[model samples]
Target: MTELRDVDFFRDPNSVVSPYSYMDDLVQNSPVWIEPNYGVAMVAGYDEALTVMRETETYSAAPMIAGPTPDYGVEFTGDDIDEQLDAVRHRLPFNDQIVAMDPPQHTMRRALIMGLITPKRLKENEDFIWQLTDRQLDVVLPRGGCELVDDYAQPYALLVVADLLGVPEEDHPMLLEKAGVAANGSLTDTTKEPPKKHGGLEHFYEYFTDRVESRRREPKDDVLGRMAHATFPDGTLPEPLEAARIASNLFAAGQETTVRLLATALQIVGDDQGLQQKLRQDRGLIPKFIEEVLRWQGPIKGNMRVARKTTTLGGVHLKAGTQVFVMHGAAGRDPRQFDDPQGFDIERPNVRRHIAFGHGIHTCPGAPLARSEVRVTLERLLDRTSAIRISEAHHGPPDARRYDYLPSYMFRGLTKLHLEFDMEA
Candidate 1:
C-alpha cells in the first residue's frame, strides 16, 4: 500500500486532518499543482493565491464554485451559469447571494449588507452578546464537561446571528437545523436534500419579507427592519426579493462559518493548557487570538473560481472554461508567505495577511461578525473553565485527537470537537 503524500491529503480533506503537511513541498516543488481527481488546478502558495484574488482582471471570481444556482422561480440561470445544470442549481439560494457575485453588482449587494452590521451596530451587540453568552454558559457550565461543538459552538453561532438578524428566539432551533443540513452538504454527501429544500430559503424570504412589510407598516430600530426600509443613493431600495435573498445568505453563510471557528478555537486552546492560561489571564487578547486561530485553523478550506479568458498562472496556461481551486488553508502555511509557516504562533507578525476571509471584491462581509462571536465566546468560556484538555485516552482512541475534518472540497471544519475541562477551581 502506498503512503499518504501531501497532495493526497487534499484528495479526501475530510479524512486528512492536517492540510498543511504538504505546505513546504508545495511551496518549493509545485505551488500550482493541478489535481486530476477534482478536475481543477489547486493554488497553494500565498503569493499565487493573492495573485488570483488581486488580479481579478486575469482571474475572475464570478464563478467561485461550480454547482447549480437557485431558480426560486426567478429567471437568473443562464447568464452566469451553465444551462444544463439549471434544474440542480435552481435549488441553491447562493446564486443571488454576495459570495457568488462579482464587482459592480457585487458592490451594490455588499453595500446593503455592510449597512446593517455597521460599527455602531457591532458596538450595540457587545452587551447583548455577552449577556447571551452568559445565558448559554449558565446552562452548559454546570455540566462540568460537554461536547463543545454540540453544546456550545452550535448554539452560540445560531443565537449570535439570530440576535443580530432579529430571528425570534422560538424559531431559531428549526431555522438552525434547516440551515445546518444545507451547510453540512458542502462537507458531506448526507446533505443531498435539505429537509426544506427551497423551503429553508423560502422561509427566510418570508421572514425577511414580513420584516420589510412590518418596517413599512411601522419602522423598528433593528438592522433587519432598517434594511427593510433602506434605499440606495439613487433612491432605489433593493427590491423586496433581493433584500430577502441577502438576508437569507447572511444567516446561512455567517452561521456555519462562525460555528466552525468557535469549535476549532476551543479545540486548539482546550488541548494546550498554556495557551488557555494566556487567554484566560488577559481577556483582551482573545480577539487577537481569534485572528491568529483563523489563520492557524479556519473553517473554510478553499475558494473556487472560473477562468474568464486564457491566462497564465504559476507558468501554466489556463483556458476560459477552466476551474481554479485556490487552497486558502494550504496557502496560510506557505513558507514563502510566512516564516516557519507551520508554527501556530498566535503573536506572529503579518498574520492579518492570511486569506481566511478571502480577498478582493468578494471578501467576506460577515468577517467582523464572526470575529465578535469567537472573541466573546472564548472570553466567557475561559472565565468559567480553569483548564481544558482532550478527554483521557482510555475513554477513546489516541488518534481521536486529530480534528475529524469535513468531507467537502469547498469548506473544511471540525465534525466533532470533544474536550474535558476542570472547573473545580
Candidate 2:
C-alpha cells in the first residue's frame, strides 16, 4: 500500500477535495500520516480526530498557526507554534473568550460565554435575525443573479455576528468591507498581486480599539459593552490590548466561517430543486439541513495542534513538538465516519455527530450563534423565494466549484460565490 504523506495534504488542499482519487487511498492507508516538509501529522479519520481534540494533555493547541500575533506580528515556527499556543491560554482579554485557553481556564471562560447564549437570548434574536436575512435577500433577490459570496453570504455572516455582538447598524457597511479585505489579505504572493492588501490588521486594530474605547466610556447591552465591564471570578478583566484581540478574533472568524457555510449550502440546495422544495415545504427540516450542510461543507478546513510528548498516531511515530492538523473537513467526509459521506443528504441521521464546530474542549464558543444564524436565514429565504437556483454566470457541480479559499491552511472559506434565484411567486 502506498503511504500517505502529510506534506502533500498541506501543500495541496485543493487536490484533496475532489475526484482526484488519491484522498480515499490516503484516508484508508494512513489516516494519521506525517507531512514531510512541515513535520506535521495529518489526522483524517473521525475517531482519530476526536482523539486528538479530547486528549488535551498529550496534545496542545500551541502549534495552531505560524504567526507571532495578529496586530504586532508573531512568527510561528514548529517550536514557537507549541510555545506560543501554551502562552496565550489564560490571557482572555474580556471575560473569558475561552477558545485560547485550556483545561480549567477554558472551562471557566466557556461558562461565561454560554450564559450569554441561553435560549432566551436566541429567542430574542429571532426577529432580528430574520430582519437581517431579509435585508440581505432584498438586495440580492432583486438582482436575480449575483455572486453569492459578496452579494449574500458576506453580509449574511457579518450581520449575524453583528447582531450577536450588538454592532451598530450604521457600522455594518464599513465592517463588511473591512472584513472582506482582511479575508483576502492572507496572500503572500508577490507576483500577480491582489487588488488590495493595504488595510488589514492595521485597520482592524484601529476599528476594534475605537470600539473598545467607546464601550469603556459608554456601556451598552451588546457583547462589546459587556466585555468592557466583565470581570473574571477573581474580579480581574483583560487589559486593553487583550480586549481588542478578542474582538478582532470574533470579527474575523465569525464573518469568514459563516460566509463559507452560507455559500456552501446555497450551492448545494440551489443545484437540486427537489431538495430545495423539500426544505421549503417542511421548514421543520431546516435545522437538520443546516447540520448536514455543515457536515458536507464545513467552513474550517482544519486546525493545527502540537504533540506535547512523543506519541504514535496512525501507526506512525510522532516525536515531541510534531505539529498535527486535525483535518475536520477531511474527517467529516471520512467513509469510516458516515456512510455516503460524499453525498449531501439533508436528512442524514449522523449530521449532529459532525465535527464542523470541532469536538471536546476547544469546540467553537460561538456555535450557538452560528447555528441560529444559518437556521433563521435559511428558513427566511425559503419563505421569501419561490425558487432558488445557481446563477449561470458561475458554473460547476455543487462540490466542484472553485472556492477562492484563503491561502491559510487553518481557516477555509470562499472569496466569492455567484448565485441566482427567482422572485416570490
Q: Go through the candidates in order and give the C-alpha RMSD of each one to the true structure.
A: 5.2, 5.5
lDDT of each: 0.69, 0.66
Lowest summed lDDT window (length 10), candidate 2: 181-190
lDDT for predicted candidate 2 compared with the true structure: 0.66
Please give the range of 10 consecutive residues that has the lowest summed lDDT in model 1: 181-190
What is the C-alpha lDDT profile of model 1 across 72-159, one tens digit per residue?
Answer: 3433222233333333433443556677665656777778777777788778767678988888778767766666666677666656
Model 2 bad stretches (over 4 Å)? 1-7, 13-23, 67-112, 180-223, 396-408
Cα lDDT of model 1 overall? 0.69
How many pairs of residues in model 2 come into backbone collision?
12
Q: Residue 45 error for model 1, in Å?
A: 1.4
| Residue 382 error, candidate 2, Å | 2.0
- Per-residue accuracy of model 2 over 1-425 as CA lDDT, tens digit each: 34344335555655434311443555666688765665668787888889899988778764354322222133344422445545553342222334445666666555545554567766766668878777766766776767777666666666666666556778876665655532222222334545423214444566767777788888787766776666555666756555555555555556667777877777778888898999888989888988998887788768777676677776788776666888887788888878988787877887899999898878886677688777877787787778887755567665655545666565665666666767787
